[model samples]
Target: MAPAIMLAADAPKLSSANTGFMLICSALVMLMTPGLAFFYGGMVRVKSTLNMLMMSFISLGIVTILWVLYGFSMAFGTDHGSIVGWTSDFVGFGGIGKEDLWPGYTIPVFVFAVFQLMFAIITPALISGALADRVKFSAWSLFLILWVTVVYFPVAHWVWGTGGWAFDLGVIDFAGGTAVHINAGAAALGVILVIGKRVGFKRDPMRPHSLPLVMLGAGLLWFGWFGFNAGSWLGNDDGVGPLMFVNTQIATAAAMLAWLVYEKIRHGAFTTLGAASGAVAGLVAITPSGGAVSPLGAIAVGVIAGVLCAMAVGLKYKFGFDDSLDVVGVHMVGGIAGSLLIGFFASGKGQSDVEGLFYGGGLDQFWKQCAGVFAVLGYSLVASAVLAFLLDKTIGMRVPEDEEVSGIDQAQHAETAYDFSGTGGGLVGSAAPALAAESKKVDA
Candidate 1:
């Protein structure tokens, strides 16, 4: 034990090939932020497109500061009596160097910290879409900072930290089926519930403003996913790394096809929006199982997620919940499906050693996966709901009706995405006229 401890102390000094690969993977994951900006930017109305992009753009600044200050320590520092970290050994990445922190892994501790930080940055950005078109920019920014602190930090500690209960429970989230996707998805629903819907949610067309932007975002997200999935290994020497890379590609293609086909059948035409959305759905679903399932299993997961998410999007209208951009459907429902189904399809040549029930590994793993899903879903829902309620009462979650009708771009940001008729669409720099118009319309 003494020798092992000594070796651990020296781990941060040893580095070579594996460290290089991990750094590249981290860069790739970081690129997903800009990609997501485009993906979401194209989905909002033309009048508010730039505002949509800004929502995502701000995360790079806000979350990065929070991550270095306390996010990393809270997420990865040694457990402090079962709730959070006790020590700040790596605050500001003080002790991180070019060495292995774990047995056989050679990347520096900073590499791991920054890679995970990229994930934290993107998760809150994902929720911004649910509140688009109606939120005050400053208020929304404050809400995210607080929300990540109260919600994201604890959940990350619970699932991925050294002494996290979920980690000890043997939950096999290779990437972020639970920590990243499901957590954000549930929180998205909570914030949307508290914030209320856009002024004309059910009545307006609310079509995406730019198909090209949507496709560009989808393409970048797909490319960056190679890093997101393969980087989970923290090494490039083994077969597992390449295997995950191949599976990520196959799964996304399958999902894209499934979504386009679904759209063609139901809406009479294949759409660029459907393809982009479907690809993202596939990526989110495979993130957990990419390193644990066979190639064929990936295809299965991608197809199912695509079809299910497509159907689930209609839930906003059917149930009158107003999820806005279908974050709950694509991320929440899709994350659950992917995380849960790996119990049956994790098999075949060059596959995960722990086979699923279909390969006669018994029903144990399937049950374990279900347990993980429930834990993530339950905690995220309750915690997020409580947080939203508290923030709503304390600081206000939604903009006033007048502000909503005039567009948050003007009322909240002092800027307009377009100046169609000068006066910034006839409402800029003037709040009273817009308020009067809004009052006259009532349910506007």
Candidate 2:
């Protein structure tokens, strides 16, 4: 009886309301992965649409199993040297009990772990956008397995773990601007450089197959992101959660408008793709700084990130690295912009006493923000490149040139995203290419 009583005393207090709220937030964050699938699925050509969706969907399966195994331990376990974490009990979550609560927070430890699991599942999925239509599904799966183990787990530790260097250094990331966005963006750039460009390069337009689908996906992402950013604070313990919620909506709206304005000025037309991408840019930007800044600051971050990501997307064309879906441009650039901007916009009245450049604070917070952003970006870039390179040399990364030109869906997954048989008997799966061949035969 005394032992049980001692165990009870050791456990932190659990707030039922906060726990329920966090569970809902976890569910909302989980929705983002599927939301991402729809977003990427709608962006790719019809032939590879299923493959694109699978890239994001597969993470849900793979990362969940990993998180339960040792992923959580490696991330949030007791810190070791500030680079990694370890706790024997967290190995299989066998040591943890339902009664256990995350220290200082009112929720159960399992709730925190599962909530974070949603994040781990999506980070690697974010990189799939850059490698779309080229990579072998098996290779992509293997990359996720390795990446979350090496890149994501450690980075999560560094950015948020109790004893992490970045956490200790006063580098604030309210959600995951540096850990998730910048890390995924930099990794995407590195992989593209290693894997090289898609087959078409600059010749083909490679326009999105379905703008409506893209719009749908973007809408879902925007909806789910509120939980992603706001839930990071755990609860309204100090009212930051509500503030984050408002800032998220404000920033996203500002970004979408800013992106449209930039598009109208530069391209002479407002496109649906621009609207979706712009909203995501806003979400990414505010994810790091929303809790620290005001709604006005959020608008500033959103507008700057929107315009900058809009312009940055064109850099792929100029630099000659094919980031197929502008992952580096929007996510990496937006993440950097948001993280750094926190240094200028942070209000002492919010999350902490920290102030940005515009506030009473000077360059102190800016440099700290820089350290967190660059550290995650650099490590992820080098590590992801190495992993991609090794896989390319082994079981292989990119599909065969012939298979790629034909479409990776049939080759990788044995099924296409859609059937075109209804369209003038368009040869079932390979509609466009097959029809072209038939037209050539008729000409001959």
Tens digits of per-residue lDDT for model 1, 311-340: 989988988777877889998888887887
Tell me the TM-score of each prediction against the true structure.
Answer: 0.89, 0.93
Model 2, residue 144: distance off in Å is 0.5
Which sections of candidate 1 miss by over 4 Å? 1-13, 81-83, 95-104, 348-352, 419-444
CA displacement after TM-score superposition, residue 356 of candidate 2 (Å): 0.5
Tens-digit lDDT track of model 2 for 1-444: 999999889766889989999999999999999999999999988878989999999999999999999999999999999999988899889999998989888899999999999999999999999999899999999999999999999999999998999999999999999999999999999899999999988998798999999999998899899889989999877898999999999999999999999999999999999999999999999999999999999999999999999999999999999999899999999999999999999998778889999998999999999999999999999999999999999999999999999988878776766757655422345565777898899999
| Stretches > 4 Å off in candidate 2 | 1-12, 423-444
Q: List the residue pairs that clash in candidate 1.
A: 12-99
RMSD of every prediction: 6.2, 5.5
